[model samples]
Target: MANTPHVYVEWRGGTCRVKWWTGEYHENGRKRYESKGGFTDEDTALQHGQDKLYEIRHGINVTNRDGSTPMTQWLDTWIDSISVDHLTLVSYKSLIENHIRPFFKRKSVAEIDVMMFRAFSKKVRSVLKERSADNVIMVFSMVMDDAVKAELRKASPVERKSRRGKYERRVKEKKRPMAIEAVDQLARNTECHLGPSGSSLIWTMAMTGMRPAELYGLRREYCWPAWPASDPDREQREESAERYGADNSMPAIRVEHQVQYVNSKLTLLPPKYQSYRTLVIPDFLASMLARLLASHESDWVFPALEGGSMGSVNFDYRYWRPAADGAEAHDGPRVAKPRPALPAVPSYAGKRLYLLRHGHKEWNDEDGHSRVAVEARQGHELPGVEGVYSNVTPLMERRIMETLQARWIGLQQSRWEGAVKIDSQLFPTG
Candidate 1:
């Protein structure tokens, strides 16, 4: 007599579940039911059972999807069928379109054996050495390897050595941090056009060094204000003037939210690990931020174009690049007509807010906000550790804030004025 099969499903989380089924197996010539498979959710499990029944009846291979296929083709289907965070999707899409698809479009996934993968990897290196394409291959290899473990592939031939060279090169490059003086100069020369708000934002990046994501996510309600502790009696007299009111008030901005694009939706997240902290703010940038806040439309200190959370993509495209050109207009006292010319100062390279955040890590001595803190502020998950940790405290954050504010004002003033010129400073003579 044939035993009837049963499918079991367990809820895993939102729109996800695990599924399995029993199938007949022989143990010492005795027939018995054995668990056959596991799934992510119930609906899929029921569908899986149906598919298995059809496969058994029709003699077809029942699988989630073919693994041995062109890497490009598989990724197209993978991204479509799965739910991924917005920011991750943006990056993953870029990786596929820019690096992966172009490299693997003509290659056949089913026929891609270990030997073929090596050949493909070598070809990638030859085409673009020490570039992001090399890194793409490494990431793709891991994804492919996972498919193999999930029983999606017969095997994967990816080699660790093939990807090791690219990673090693990246590590070596990080040691050569961009010259802080050069970056500071770039900031100073460009401040005039960054606008009061824009200048404050840029300065913030240069000094305390939050990433674009962190900078864009700043809000008015998060600011911190201080009264002179030495003059307590005097502080109360000025307190009324400093307190933020309906029309004007004290200016303070704190670290609270971070901007991240998830599932194609721009959104704000709490400082990674509830890692929100405050800064003392340099007197100058603080003053600038105060002025900027007075002009803001809402509680958001620097709102986006559409009243939604601002994003780094918009920050660079709409603000930074244009402001860079404007700064070049006044770079040093113009001797003659302002002719459009590229600033001898480099654009956002190592000089970006992202790099400034790294500088913050260098100056920060507290337990919670270290280099890892910088990455977290930038909305990036720290390598080998989860996004949030229990150790980050408000005092540590406050110290970081003070460091950032002072750095912003000092670095900008120093850099823009040609204080750190490595080469002969050039200005429009016309």
Candidate 2:
């Protein structure tokens, strides 16, 4: 190659050095060169020049200048580069600033190696709870992983090391599903705390296994199962569905999107994992849903107390707390008398509405349905062979419907035997 590197004794100082041609001319048409010096002898300097020449010819530049990027600086770039909902972004930012940033301090990105990561993990555990520490570690790992992809580091140091000995086993409080009786009672109590309309939320969520956000985003048009054929607009709607290529099948709710607040404004986003599925529900749930729809002209199947989509804060503090733990006089906005509380569901004394979702899975399991159908109904994906070969059958869907209906009937009988009057409208067949 022309203008290649050569080792020589300097004319000015008689010192040994290597001058490498960069193969590029400046704007003024002068050759640009790079030099490495301070060698004690001619042979050493010549060897250095030869090695650099080979690297230049082969396009094998291994310089890692990106390692000089500081942890704090990279973090800012990483956070800005990530794409997520506003709520999730807020959570990641809070953890990065409050938990991760302080530990990393002013360290350069290169300094965070496997050993450094292990020491930081231990340090975080000492200050934070097990779960909190795990969350912080998870976010840090994600940050570092992105850095690796950005070529700021050669490799990621984060790993899920198996814990051993006394500190190894994580203490996980498993959520146990509520009994059919407990579910009915939770629903009845919810009726008292909120109103007749709000009670529908309990049964629908329990039977359908929809995520809370999915339920909140349920529009009037998406509910096919709940709409009976007898409605006056049924034919016109069916015609419209055919024209638009819609699935107007019964016993299903289309889970296309979820309502979430982004910057204090309600935004529609795809369901978790982008699992846009249609959940086939029991006939009992469909009937309950129909009644609910007839009662409200609002677009959402389950609207908030003040209108629009339900807020997590209001649903938790006002609805779930009062429904599970009972409400005192003057509780909630425009409240008056106290409401009687039911016995809290097993493992759900904290009033976690998510347990209803857990309970739905248990019921499906108890009914001896195939794992594929159960997973599909719950919007969860199976792994490996099962995910590939398994499919939900018609028989499985029918079984789910029959089991849920029988459970609702059993609850009615149990209530009747206990000298409690059954509402006629609740069970017209009875």
Candidate 3:
């Protein structure tokens, strides 16, 4: 072959031009172009081009490679490992096919370079927020990685490039934690008016820091009036008891599994790794949970409106918010108009249930309890790389519940200035 400055080879579509510095040539006479500073000379271009093309066609690489695998194949292999209980297959499949596959499809995974990855990430960021883009990228990276593990690609170029520089902030959305005093006010004013179910709902969440899912997912078996039979913390204490001659007291709750509604079926799954652990329950909340459990139906502690499980978001919006609103004495949005009073119905009933969850998280954090404990209790793992594979433990759950109750007590007495003020009716018990 001539030492042509610009390499010319037959690609699937037609004759293609590859820069002298960056091109690949296959035994079948196909040539591919690379984004890097392509070959500066004809000889360099020809040799490198041939090497890449052969490597892509033959799956020959020192470290790892996905050259022989189509990007679609890699994606499917990667997607198989994800537990999509929280997300629907349609949504997951859409993101993979529409958003992810088109960009990387048919490209040799080994050939994906920094520039290509940067462009891919930028495009994803344009569609999703920075944080969401990061997540999408993480999924992509995981998929590509698995492809490499399966000998589909040499390694994930996206992962390598992702580690190189200051990461671009993908999502800018900020969710402000609810104000602590507002929570207290809501808790105090609403406690009495909110029926046992409602009151118990708020109290349990504020104290245990459980996610609405965990709350709804709660089974009668998890709650203990006295103490759990097989609490690891107590077992650890018992070991200490044997060594130091101290009496070991078991924990109050033994949260193991939670019910998740998938495909209209309530499937029992382990809590997020963080939430899987148990925590000690405080005396007050322990008593409350015990009583609440005593009064509950056997299957679900907090039944959804009908037999079907509720979407956590929907439940919070329709039920919890309305319940919170019922505790308020005032009518709709306050007005300075000539009207003597607003409608008899509470003003905030239309609000979503997220307010309560947000409020509870804030109250928990304000006190000395750890975020990990709260996350574990709520079945939310710490976000980022570490959350993917973590599991929950009984002891962790107990600590989370105990910490939550302690925080709830603290919130009852807290009165911070300039906070969102729910009426005194919301926190009636305090």
Candidate 4:
């Protein structure tokens, strides 16, 4: 036997054999060794042994030499390492189990070449929408990246050009903002169907532009008729007033949490992007909310019928759909014939409820509010150092509230005028 550090070459019967320590332990507490030989030349056999020794020293697992670990096995380990919100984890699991594992489970990590990935992407695109396919590709890329880090693969086969090229050409549908008249009509119809609290809830969403989850998370304690002086930041009110042209004493709503359904349970989680913001409301909306609050005895401003947080599914079905679709109140009838369909609200038909928030942003943009102020109000952080230093001044808040007030009054007047015509036909007052 001729020996190097962790490699050896032996000559037997006119053939040279190379062997190296693989640096792995067996279950019986013995070190593992791998050998390959059939070289007529002793130097070539010794060189092969030296290369294997280098691989072992650099932490490469010889057991995975053929990349035999299935993609599904690696994915299980990858998923277990993830630390995120439960709902987010659920989403990841869904993407992996439903989309990824089905296609790649039996394939080894090394088997996923660029061509194979492109084919997988095409298959995903065929089944899912563009945005959804993009999301799956993103998660797949992440898993492949982890495989590279774990030394399961030499490098990730996910190429940016292959993943983004086709999807990037797919134009994202622009969200159309609702007209003020439509918003008012939606509110009136909600009032007609679900009464005053429902009307107020829709109006609050329109005025504040809060995310649906954030709106659901609003509690009685967070809704204020006037800014709370006991707040830790109360001392900044004077400076904030002078800076942003805000009254500082005006009513505001604290938006620190959002309602999320995790593990089939309603959970109060931090706002999106972890952005906590306080929104000042118009005087008219403040009065409307005040009336709304008087109707609820629970901590949640918009509690479910049985109490606790209101689920979006329940709100959409029981309240929003009927209002948006229009409904009629019947006197009394046992007739079995299908009742005449209520008139479809043409302005709001096929529209999502979140468009109200988009409409609010449109109002802000039309009013020429600063980018930082708009983003902050919308609970988005400005990019770069600007977000760090630029704060929403009191004056900015005051102006925002004032502008919203004007829009609200204008919408109300338009709605009232529209209602009078319908009322005259229904009541026929001389």
Candidate 5:
């Protein structure tokens, strides 16, 4: 008859109905009402209406809203809101499209739980490596986290571990550094395949710990030995010279940027961790760099065959593999003889060009350089306040350069002695 608070009861024929104002409104400013009909008595209808009112007051959407948004649609919206690096965005898109979407496409965010995630992880681990599977799970967790923030779901179901047992953690393999002998052999072979320029590139990477992308990004102007006293003056350079001194200013490469290919487009971007650094090379390597620079007309220190930014794939296929694996001569009239294989060390075989960077780290660590200095040189950010206040000092740079110079000299002597011994053996010199 009369309205009882937010609920009212009505009888139609043999059935009774109860309707309640939800105390919420649509965007058009109209009050929303929910109704449950087909009750045998007014008491039952009234009790159900009271229970729904309690749910509405406690922030539950009483319109059966759970599981309405599909996981795929929610992930699409979440990905659109992500503002990350182009490469990172590309990786996220790949994981979502290829891995995540296929499994959870039909499910809603509310329906996903820890058990579902564990099953998904099991399926992913079967197809992918441990690290790769972990990355997929991480991306999925990020999407679920955003869903929780948006109130589409109550919480993220992606747990680091299940209550029953531990999930498989990613096992990081210890990177073995290339020994001095291996480095020398690789460098000499690189020279044979790609000439002095490629040899210089490999040696530089070994000594400097620069990323392959950073090495690819190196410009003629970034080489300090090539810079004239008065040409294109920058404050950073002036400060470095003044602090480190003119005579002690060992030839160095300025690691300001990296060149990477994203979405079929070559893009030059800031180095990883935004760690713009200066890498000083020993005089021996500097001299080699100088000779290499003199022969090249292009601004790029290591240009492609046609001249411009060189791709890693191109470098690996055309230069690195052939140098390491050895190549045969074609049967053309003017074709050169087959080049002999470089020293076949198992450690060096099937290794990427980045190993030289790791070798450099080994050299630095062996030399007992400060952790901060080594990390700074490698363009890695040191954790905590030390990274904020600490910087690579002039003395530290000089010391690093000296240590590198000594190592270079020692390796050269060893190689020379080895060569002489082989010559003597071949000639049977008295």
Candidate 6:
């Protein structure tokens, strides 16, 4: 990226010096230069200038502002410039602090190469499992790619597969999707612990495929359900539902934003990938939500048990884990009577909330519904022509509602261990 250099000789302070044009000029129209000094002789100084000219010409030593920076320093600079949501930004910073920075030490960014990265990868794999290491390495690769773009390195040291047949993908190990019956067990277990209200979050998430954050941030104004209300307000509820794109054919929940922690403070922001979407729910789910809402007075559709917004609270550990994995009764001198043991939902025993979303996808796949409709309902795009041309038909929406409602009815009929806990009524008896 440099141009031809002009070699020159000079003397200052009784010492020989060499100077050369660096293919740049100032705004004042004077050519900028790079120089070497204290050569102790004319020939030596002149030779130094000539050598620099060849180095610059061959692109071996073309002096520029973007020189090598320490790996840790470069990572800090790169992370600061990246645009990501606060939670994601926090995850990337953790990867850098725990894995990338410590291993690299004071090594310069330019010092890294494909071989060095491969070794670093092996180290990560040794410490962490294969999939987890891959996740950590992914963040590091993003930093290296930026370094290449900035001219700190000619190419990314992170070796990757060719973009063709048998292409490699990131290692993302997902838990098996929960079966519909198992989803019922998970919901019923929560019900057994905290009555019907506790189970609503479980059923809503499993059926609607709402992310935990989105569900936690759901507002009453956005979700208007009519069934199970002691006094129905059809006009007012429908008006509220219309604002978020609900209709007679398809009852929907609006996912406008999510609750998250930003700069150590709870905040509301757009959903992941900005996937602001309307998701259709079965009549049963809509009714169940109405019942849950009727019992609460907060603006949040789902408030914390302690009577406030569930903002950035670690619900997974305090609430979800106990319900999913089940807990043994604990009794000691500090307790009068031990609480009853929570029986684990076999399919969700070791899983998390994400698996419920996965379960939703599996249900759609099994129902033989339109791919485009399924993708749209799940807040995802199908990609290519399938995503652009295809649209969700009224028939597809009907089929979706029928299939989801069937699962709820099937649980009502099944004589499983947790079937007794399933709510006998959601929609009107009529």
lDDT by residue for model 6 over 27-87, one digit each (tens)? 9999888877888888878877777677677765535344558888898899889999877
Best-matching candidate per lDDT: 5
- Candidate whose TM-score is highest: 5
Which stretches of model 6 miss by more than 4 angstroms?
1-20, 26-65, 162-177, 226-249, 329-339, 415-430
The lDDT, on a scale of 0 to 1, for candidate 3 is 0.54
C-alpha local distance difference test of each model: 0.53, 0.71, 0.54, 0.75, 0.76, 0.74
lDDT-best of 3 and 6: 6
lDDT (tens digit, per residue) of candidate 3 on 203-298: 666555566666667666555553343334666535433432232143344456656667676677765453464445566766666676576564
TM-score versus the correct structure, for each prediction: 0.55, 0.76, 0.59, 0.78, 0.81, 0.77
Native-to-model Cα distance after best TM-score fit, residue 153 in candidate 6, in Å: 2.7
RMSD score of candidate 4 (Å): 5.7
Which 10-residue window in model 4 sums to the lowest lDDT? 421-430
Candidate 2: RMSD to truth:
6.5
Model 5 alpha-carbon drift over 4 Å, by segment: 1-23, 33-67, 162-175, 227-233, 244-248, 325-338, 420-430
Q: Rate residue 403 of model 3 by lDDT.
A: 58
Instruction: Residues 4-59, candidate 4: write the lDDT tens digits.
Output: 76788878888978877787778999877778778998788988888777776787
Steric clash pairs (candidate 5):
none
* Worst-scoring 10-residue span by lDDT in model 5: 421-430
Write the residue-wise lDDT of candidate 5 on 139-189 in tens digits.
Answer: 998998888778777678888665576676656655555566666666777
Candidate 1, which segments miss by more than 4 Å at Cα?
1-77, 80-84, 97-110, 162-191, 224-285, 298-300, 303-353, 365-390, 393-430
Task: Order the candidate numbers by TM-score, best to worst.
Answer: 5, 4, 6, 2, 3, 1
Selected candidate, larger lDDT, 2 vs 3: 2
Q: Per-residue CA lDDT of candidate 1, range 1-430, in tens?
A: 1123454444455543323332344577644422334455556566755556555456443243354466666777666755555555566777778766776787655556778777767777777756566677866775676556555565666766654444543454342243445454445444443434555566666554565676778765554333222223464424423433222232334565788866577688765555554334545656666677676665555555455455735666555554443333423575543433436444343233455566555555332456545554444456554544534444544556666555545655655675544234444212
Rate residue 119 of model 2 by lDDT.
Answer: 89
Number of backbone-clashing residue pairs for each candidate, in the order shown: 28, 1, 59, 6, 0, 0
